[model samples]
Target: MATGPAKDEKCCLVAVTLDKDTIGQGPPDVEHERRVAIYDLLEKNRFVLRDYADEGPYNLRLQIIDRKLVLAVDRQDGVPLITHILSLTPLRRIVRDYFLICESYYAAIRTAMPSQIEAIDVGRRGLHDEGSHLLIERLKGKIEVDFETARRLFTLISVLLWKGQGR
Candidate 1:
C-alpha cells in the first residue's frame, strides 16, 4: 500500500496552468473567477492520488481537450505523475444551470430588491454546492480532494465552461 501525506501535512498545488487558447476566449468574469479560484486553491487544498508513492506539493495544468477535462499532474520538481482525463459530459447540465443562476445572482445584486437578491444568492449557493458534490463523485477513484478544495475546483471548472456550454 502506498503511504499518503501525513495527517498534519497538507498537500497543496504549487503551480496551476490553464489552456491559454480556450480560457482566453472566456469573458472577463470567467477570467476573474479563474484567477480567484486558482489563488484560493493554491493557498490551501488537500489533494492526494491514491496508490501512488510520490510526495507533493503538486503542479497541475488543466485544459479541455476534445470535450474532456484533462488534468496533467506533476510533482513539485516537475516529475510527471499521471494525466487524468474526465468526461465533461456529466458536468455540462450542472455547469450550465450554475452559470445561469450566477448571472441572475449578479444581476439581482445590481438592481433587484433585497429579498429577491437574497433568494437568488441562496439558489446560487445551492447550485454551487451541487456542482462541488458532483465533482467529488466523479473524481472518486482517480483523486481524493476535500470538500472545500472540490468547491474551489468547481468554480474554476464553471468559469472554464463559459457561455453556458462545455469546454
Candidate 2:
C-alpha cells in the first residue's frame, strides 16, 4: 500500500495547489478569486516542462518558499518531476502597480464617469498583460505554457501575493 497522493486525483496532471498553510483561505473575496482561478486553470490549460513533456500531465504546487516563488512540478502519482524557483523581486513592482491601479479602477467604477472607468480598466488590463509576460519570461527555460495559462497563473500569483501575504 503506497501512501501518497491518491490514484483517483489524476486528471492528466492538471491539478494545482497553493500551499494552504502558507496562503491561507484568505478573506472571502480573495478565497473566491483563488478558487475561480484554480477552476479556470484546470478546466483548460497547457502546462509542460521544457524537457519532461512526456512525463506529464503535471501537478503543480505554487508557493513562496524562502521569500522566493517556488514551482514544484510532479506526476499525478507523486513522482517528483521538476522544480522552478523564481525571485519575487522581479515581479514586486509590477504586482504593486497592478494593485494600485486596481484600487483606482474599483473606486472609479462607483463614483467616476463611464469614460474614467474605461481608462482605468485599460490600464489595469495592460498591467495584467505585462505581468503575464514577465511570468512567462521567468519560466521560459523551465516550462512551456500558453499566454492564457500564464495569465491564469498570474492571477493566482496575484491573489497569493495580495496585501502582505507574500511574506
**Residue 80, model 1, lDDT:** 89
Name the best candidate (by TM-score).
Answer: 1
Worst 10 residues of 1 by lDDT: 1-10
On a 0 to 1 TM-score scale, where does candidate 2 land against the true structure?
0.83
What tens digits encode model 2's per-residue C-alpha lDDT throughout 1-167?
A: 11123333223346788876567555565667677878778777777787887787778898887768888998865799888899999998998898788778867977999999999999998998999999999999788787888888998888768745442
lDDT, residue 160, candidate 1: 61
How many residue pairs of model 1 clash at the backbone? 0
Task: Report the lDDT tens digits of candidate 1 across residue range 1-167.
Answer: 01123244436666778777656566666667777888778777888776453566677777788878888888766788899999998888888888888778777878999999999988888888888999999999888888999998898777766733743
Per-candidate total of colliding backbone pairs: 0, 1
Clashing pairs in 2: 13-57
* Poorest 10 consecutive residues by lDDT, candidate 2: 1-10
**Runs in model 2 with CA error above 4 Å?**
1-13, 25-29, 163-167
